[model samples]
Target: MVKKQNIPAKEKIVSVVLLAGLILFMAIVIGPGFSEPSSPNQNVAEQMLPAGWSAVGGWEIYPKGRLYEKINGREPLFDQYGVVRLRYASVSKGTNDFEVYFYDMQTPDGALGIYLANTPSEFDELELGTLADISGGQVRVLKGRTYLEIFSLAEQTPKDFLIDLSSALVETIPTEKEARRTAVELLPKQGRVRGTLILNRENTYGLAKLTDIFSASYQQDNDEFDYMIRTISPSEGRKMIAAVGEEIFEFDGEIIQSETNSLVAEFMGKTLILNQTGDFLIGLYGAVPPDQGRRRLDQWIETMKDQLHGSGK
Candidate 1:
């Protein structure tokens, strides 16, 4: 025997609606992990193939979690720059092969961050993407929100091929015109050495816990010096000072305490004049004396202030 209860049409509709809502919520919470990563539609392979070259296969996509499978030991560097996804493809021309890697780094700055961290043995600038350079056997580019790399698998890597491929890749990626001006605008430009500016995402100047630092070299009075700037929360700055207090003292040099939380010290022939103002840390490194270093640091701060005030930024 079976017993059945007749449900009202409105009740059935409400029940179905409730179930649909639940499913939607679950999808919102857990769907992304299972779904395919949303990689940019870059139809690059067809253009990359030369007359005799053949693509090995379709593009291979690697999300952050699976990036390690492709890069292995270098995953952390990509992770540091907020890499979204990686689209990779390979092609072979007889015995000559080439690999193209497109890393979606989330933002232009994120792309540049990774680029700055890479200290290449030599730099040959290329006028492709936002910033591009050829180093060793690779051509690296930072354009839009992407960090693209093309590696040469053959002994004879033609510079013309690299240039053409880089130009093509740059055309595919989007760029923000306004973002072209970066924090470099905040820095005083006078006497700055071209091609000497760089960003260190972490552990700047071999100081542990010092991160997101921008530095440049300036030529003054027949001498060159490094000026560094970093924005940090007051609490984090204090914590860094506390964490590195012992290490700072361990330097085999004269330590001159000029002001509270500010020091002019000589370490390994370099004079370091570090000053903390609110949420900003500024330092100048040179062979100058403590008094000269302090005066120079103050002048730089004033110059920065004037620049900002003039720009109304």
Candidate 2:
């Protein structure tokens, strides 16, 4: 036996809440789309390389069943070169990030250079085996092997995509050799200096020692012998004549010239020129000044001529 009573507004509210919960449960279990899994295609273009820049030359396209415009010499984001690779992946919850890996190329000695890793925690992490950094909206290798990687937390546009690709391309291109040559020229020279000798290595050039023989000195910093030895072969005499044309002098039975501020003696047998441009000595080695030295110089010149002819023979 029960007395029927009107439900209060609060009770009605409770009933409504329970009914909504049941409806939600039914929707979860039997919704029309629930049985058919939704396969949304990932918009990779919006996720990777920027526009206009194609991965030309040395790159491979990835992902199965997808078509990409072939850009020669272009590479994938994870590709490697010269024992280095760049790896990129989107984070599930945290900030976007990527990594750089450096590996030692196989060496004959069997000792490997260390591996390096760079990650986002340090942002500029430089480990023994890897190095990585994020800059200008791109993750680039400053010191480690592989050059650059561009990814996006936002949609990737063609513009952004090409920006990354261009970076990689720029990194891969060979540096100009002239710049390297100039750098080498700027480097200090170091070597031993011997007594002055005509360095006729292919051409007659002069070499004067700035230091004692076997001593070390920087060529860039120290003064070098003025002229290289002129001729190594007697057959090269005509060419030498052309090279020294009209600058010749007839002294001690030899044709000599003063060119580039140094006396150039050619096929001379006697009477060496002692024209002191300054205090520098130019006579035959071990010979003193004036007449007595002149005789010795003449003899020495004859010996040189004989050596040259014998070598040719």
Q: Which one is best on TM-score?
A: 1
- Point to the candidate with the largest lDDT: 1
Which lDDT tens digits does candidate 2 get at residues 1-313? Answer: 9999999999999999999999999998987533432222345322333333322222332221111122124332112212232222222212323222212222201111111222233333222112234434445333222233444444433443433443543344234333112111211223323222111223222222111111112122232222212212333433333343343332223444544332334433322232211212223322123354445334434534422222321
The residue ranges of model 1 lying beyond 4 angstroms of the native Cα positions read: 1-58, 91-97, 106-110, 176-180, 183-209, 216-221, 231-269, 275-280, 290-313
* Sequence-dependent TM-score of model 1: 0.60
Candidate 1 lDDT for residue 127: 79
Range of the 10 consecutive residues with the lowest summed lDDT in candidate 1 = 304-313
Residue 179 accuracy (lDDT) in model 1:
31
- Tell me how candidate 1 scores on lDDT: 0.71
Which tens-of-lDDT digit does each residue in 174-268 have in candidate 1?
66665323444456677887667788667666666556777888988876788887655555655665444445576555666644556676766
- Separately for all candidates shown, the number of backbone clashes (residues 3 or more apart, or on different chains) is 0, 41
RMSD per candidate (Å) reads: 8.4, 25.6
